[model samples]
Target: MIVDKKNDATGVLLRNGHIVLPDKTYVGDLRIRDGVIAETGQLEPEEGERTLDCSGCYVLPGGIETHTHLQLESMGTVTADDFETGTRAALYGGTTTVLDFATQFHGESMAEGLARWHKKAENNCYIDYGFHMALTEWNADLKSEMASIVEGGISSFKIYMAYKNNMMLQEDEIYDALSETKRLGATVGFHCENGLLIDVLVKEAKARGNTSPWYHQWTRPPVFEEEAITRLETVNALLHADHYVVHLSTADGLDAILKARSSGIDVIAETCPQYLLLDNTRYGTEMSEDFEAAKYIMSPPLRDKSHQEPLWDGLACGDIQFVGTDHCS
Candidate 1:
């Protein structure tokens, strides 16, 4: 965890690392020159070079954080972290890059939306960042804009199955978005959940006086998400396009994704730390003492304790390909 004061030409030698890989780990050394890796092996430190002793520590690539929401205004509340603090946190966690969503609200221009995210991040962020436009409202003109966006250096897109009233795209609209992405040779990621079903469940919970933090989980059960993923898998089959599911929370949802993949559906599964570690028990805690459990209330709410082991097992077996914090703040 130490850095050297030597000049760029001198380069710092990171000595004796427990290097990690997809399949294994090994002891090695890495050389950094002018802020980039120059060499790695049983490297001998150059004369007068700065050196960082990484003895007994793991050397790994800076993580590529694929999901984050910074400086986002949603449901009448601004998120906790802005670009500066969010990227700082990522760097602290060993992530050097982030791919955050740049949202185009209903009736907003795509160019303007991308520009706004840029202004928030360009000079202010502490680490590298990129944007994935969340296509909230799609139409003929907006669909045509996809090509220009890709040419402008942003390629992937997103659609929400939740946020039906505000950000969600229906099944047909979802197809259209994925079709456009396929035409542009790009991919579309979805927030999988039946927004309509969730709405009904939420109202039911409220009418029954179940307004505690726990009510959020009741409104969006595992089947709600599993249904959405199942539906999207069918559509992705027809379109045969590049696709992804974001923040997959339930074990049943993971089961659906694995089924699709096993059947040769080319799709990526992305899950978050909350799903892998936490559970709906937090809601019960919030109901009892810690009112802050409401803070844990998010779309595709956490599942039962039984889901935790399955999600971890899925990650271990490669059914789930990657992980993120889903760091909205």
Candidate 2:
């Protein structure tokens, strides 16, 4: 079992392990003092120092989870894991830091949303944590609050182009918010899906007597995601804003991003493991009850298997910058 060496004043030495670095990997020793790495390379144990023989083991840096949704409430249900349970699980899996979305619900101030999240996480996280304020509503007052939010240490913000009547902002609002965030030198991330089109599609599906989980994927196709992404990128290009696309899951969407970046748009993107490893087939599976497919339901729902390779390729070529779990639980 691994041990916690946070209070080891005399320091702890990890010897004879293969250390993985950005550009190279080599067998070496790493020494830690006061809970931080103090040195590396060939080293002998000093008096009062605790040494661990790490033969045949590999040492790597801790992970930073770029997206998470701990203790979040949605659709009249709260997530299964709170900040305490979620962060503890993250730590167990080697994530050292997590950036969670502090959502500002409609009709609420950004500060109130952030304060609610802080209350839930202040004494609950097991690892370092930060917030990316998600602005569900935008206005002159909300725009003014951006500065204070930044000053309070939130350098990133999130907006949704989907979830109309709930978390989504209009195109003009998104453009204005992006402009404000850009002016403040902060990055904005987006949930890009065509909420309006989705609503129409859902209604059409239900009218046709299709109410199964399979209709969930059928109603929100890849083109909706592509359309929303293209729209966001077009707006950002006009503003030259540094922005991010969260939970990107389609080849069409990736193509839109690639085209935008080729023209020098300052946009970055992230994808979840679900998109990389799973596909829409999960929704059509004839296993258990049809509702079983609900387990895989998420925005920008999984695409066809044909789309997976492009996503993997995007990651390998550095077109996609992060792989977050979008860990709702």
Candidate 3:
């Protein structure tokens, strides 16, 4: 395997078949000392230590999973996976580094929320990690906290337009965050689903006795995502900020991002494997509206099948910047 040499005093050593670095590959032996990779290609074994024979394995860098949500508190409950279990699961999946977002609970200080996440992760992670603060509340104090947070290694910040009645930020609040993150040289991330409009639809659906899991996607269609994306793009433009849209699942949403970029806005979007592989209709009757089907629930819930082609095209043509599992558990 392509091993990191800086992880130990004796470094790393690899031999046998092929190893893939960030770029290029060599078929031979690699030697590392003191944790840094010391040599590569066919090598003679030293007198001390052990040797591993990787005859038919593909040696590559440890995977870096850039998006995940673990132990996040939501809707009067906390998600099942805490940082410990979450990080462990990531390691088990072959991920080496993960970037999870820290949430700012309503009425609590953003700094306090970040500190709490730190305590949850401290001494518990089996791999390297980073944080991106999720701004649910926008105010002068929290906006000002961005500078120090970026200085302290928590640089990226994201705001949601999807978590209506919970985390949706009004236009002014979104602009505040965009401007603040731009000032701090931090990238902004977006969850683009029109909250206000979806709330109306959700209320209407519930009033009509349509409160089922499938109604989740039924109430908030791709049009709402498109509208929210358009709104956020305008705000980001005013701030002259480059931002990332996370887990984009619909063609309309992708088109909004592409159009924004065409207009010269720095709007990078990412898709998740779930969206690429799963469709809304697959939820079936059992996972439809009742019971614990909520277990399969996520914000910006799965979309219809027609969008999959464009999603794949975005990935294949490199219009999408990256793909994440969006795996919380």
| TM-score per candidate | 0.94, 0.94, 0.89
Which clashing pairs does model 2 show? none
Q: In order, how many clashes per candidate?
A: 0, 0, 18
Off by over 4 Å in 2: 1-6, 286-291
Which candidate leads in lDDT? Answer: 2
lDDT of 3 by residue, 199-317 (tens): 88888988988776767777788998899999998887787786899989899999999999999887888899888888887555533665556665676888888899999999999
- C-alpha displacement of 286 in model 1, angstroms? 8.3
Q: 147-236, model 1: which lDDT tens digit per residue?
A: 999999988888888875788788788888888888888888889999998888878888987888877887888998999999999988
Give every collision pair in model 1: none
Model 3: CA > 4 A from native: 1-12, 22-28, 285-293
The worst-scoring run of ten residues by lDDT in candidate 2 lies at 284-293
**Sort by lDDT, top down from the best:** 2, 1, 3
Model 1 per-residue lDDT at 275: 90
